[model samples]
Target: MASVSTIYTMGTFLSRAEGLGQRVRVLVEGNWITGTPLSCDGHGVILDSGAEGQFLVRVEAISAASYALPEATVPRPRPHEGSGDRVRDDADDRAYEGTYATVASLS
Candidate 1:
């Protein structure tokens, strides 16, 4: 049997993502809770979901979680490379596609 490399869990992901300033999607029921990772430990994660919005998700309740893959293309788009409207729209689509990717929390 191949030895497992690392223990991959939402707690680990949330803790790491918080440091990287990354947004994350937590799967609850059949919906995805999209938010920025504020803090996390072995038990739960606190998510900042915009203006005065924050939610704590228990480690066990987070059936799944994900972050966007880093793009090597460029930080920001050129003059007319990509439109913000399109980017926002695509975010939803990407989530449904099972990748469950989200924009970085880096502002």
Candidate 2:
């Protein structure tokens, strides 16, 4: 199996590279996610959430685009009595926007 990396939004298009101007759909299964064109690398795709830190996804298969997002149900946040709304400071907000992806093949 070949490995491929990519960046994508929950319901938006996927970004192939830093500035490749290419977009595609993505499907994830368990710890393996696959997509077309297979980013320049063959490891994993970085998810673009306007957040920091790159997510490397190891691709297992690359055919028919058969994969689904992992089913994760986050519990509702408990309300705090006097906790001010959590807000990211200016610097923190800026740092959160940078994102990238790395793909690699195993075996």
Candidate 3:
């Protein structure tokens, strides 16, 4: 759902949205293109869409836009966290297994 809709150019909308929040929601790809506008000009704009990564879009292409202005609340945990799997850290394992000891002996 779009919070606000505007008929301004992408650059104009971005400049205005900066006061509210640089992060904007625009219907670029039907999949995922909502993110913070990294840079914009009269031609194209670069959007740093999280996960989806940054991409360029023509200013003229963007019409009405919206913002996912997150209310002041606790951030939600990412899906990768606590997925019943221990995150592997080779350095920690190496330290536990005393790889340093082997290296020290060689030195």
Return the top candidate by TM-score: 1
TM-score of each: 0.57, 0.26, 0.47
lDDT of each: 0.68, 0.38, 0.57
What lDDT is obtained when candidate 1 is compared to the true structure?
Answer: 0.68
Largest lDDT belongs to which candidate?
1
Ranking of all candidate structures by their lDDT, best first:
1, 3, 2
Candidate 1 lDDT, tens digit per residue, 1-107? 88878878778888888999998778865557677888887887888877537777777877788884543332343345554444345554454443333334321
TM-score head-to-head 1 vs 3, winner: 1
Model 2 accuracy (lDDT, Cα): 0.38
TM-score attained by model 3 = 0.47
Write the number of the candidate with greater lDDT, choosing between 2 and 3.
Answer: 3
Which window of 10 residues has the lowest lDDT sum in candidate 3? 98-107
Query: Number of clashes in every candidate structure?
Result: 0, 9, 0
lDDT of 3 at 94: 51
Backbone clashes in model 1, listed as residue pairs: none
Q: Tens digit of lDDT per residue, candidate 2, span 33-77?
A: 333333334454543322233334434332323232333343335
Q: Compared to the true structure, candidate 1 yields what TM-score?
A: 0.57
